[model samples]
Target: MTTEHLDGNALAGPLGEIFAVDVTTCTGRCASCGLTTPVASLHVYGPEPGLVARCPGCDEVVLRLVRAPGAAWLDLRGTVCLRVNLPD
Candidate 1:
């Protein structure tokens, strides 16, 4: 089966609920290919089982978010670092 995906901007709503700032603006480094880019540039798929964001450069899974009844799970193992901008 073919899987269609969206840009990481789709994660704005969900991620906004958990983070104080806009996560889409954050820069992420892929652990696999060492590619670094804005989270908004990553490709995102799914919202049913959860959301998975993959690196655009190497197509490696960069981030994963799963929401349950009262809890949420986020996996960033594929990302070495996430640089989020903060107000001074």
Candidate 2:
């Protein structure tokens, strides 16, 4: 079976809320592949229970975010680190 997917741009809004920055332009290192790339280049799936972002290099789940009524959860286990250039 084929699962539908979208680019990381879809996550910009939700991630912006959590990061308070433009995450789509940020770079992230994939823990599984050790590859560094722009977050906006990753693959994104779902607005169902939450949003899932996967690495384009190794297909590893790089990030997962869930927003509840009064709470929110963010997982970055699959990402080693993220590089964001904060504005001056």
Candidate 3:
């Protein structure tokens, strides 16, 4: 018998989502001064290193903040529908 094989990754996109903050979207507060400032550039945020300020809306806090929990995903191959369960 003759057969052909295909690589699943052949269809993957060249640009995958980078888990990072968009500098244009980052606003932080100054720890030394009571001021809300936008991050000058994206280079400021690296992988859990260095220091940046907090949300400017609240000067009492600095740029450092806890990360939110991510949405849980279940891989159900050949599934035919959608389902979601949120806690109370």
Cα TM-score per model: 0.95, 0.91, 0.24
Encode model 3's per-residue lDDT on 18-70: one tens digit a residue: 22333333343344453444443212221133222223334232322223245
Q: Considering only N, C-alpha and C atoms within 3 Å, which residue pairs clash in candidate 1?
A: none
- Model 2, runs deviating above 4 Å: none
Ranking by TM-score: 1, 2, 3
Winner by lDDT: 1
Worst 10 residues of 1 by lDDT: 1-10
**TM-score: which candidate is best?**
1
Write one digit per residue (lDDT tens) for candidate 1, span 1-88: 1368899999999998889999999999999999999999999999889999999999989999998888889999999999999999
Query: Which of 2 and 3 is ahead in lDDT?
Result: 2
Q: What's the CA error at residue 39 for candidate 2, in Å?
A: 0.7
**Model 1 residue-pair collision total:** 0
Off by over 4 Å in 1: none
Residue clash pairs of candidate 2: none
On lDDT, the stronger of 1 and 2 is 1
Q: Kindly provide the TM-score of model 2 when superposed on the true structure, using C-alpha atoms.
A: 0.91
Model 3: pairs clashing at backbone N, Cα or C within 3 Å:
29-54, 53-63, 54-62, 54-63
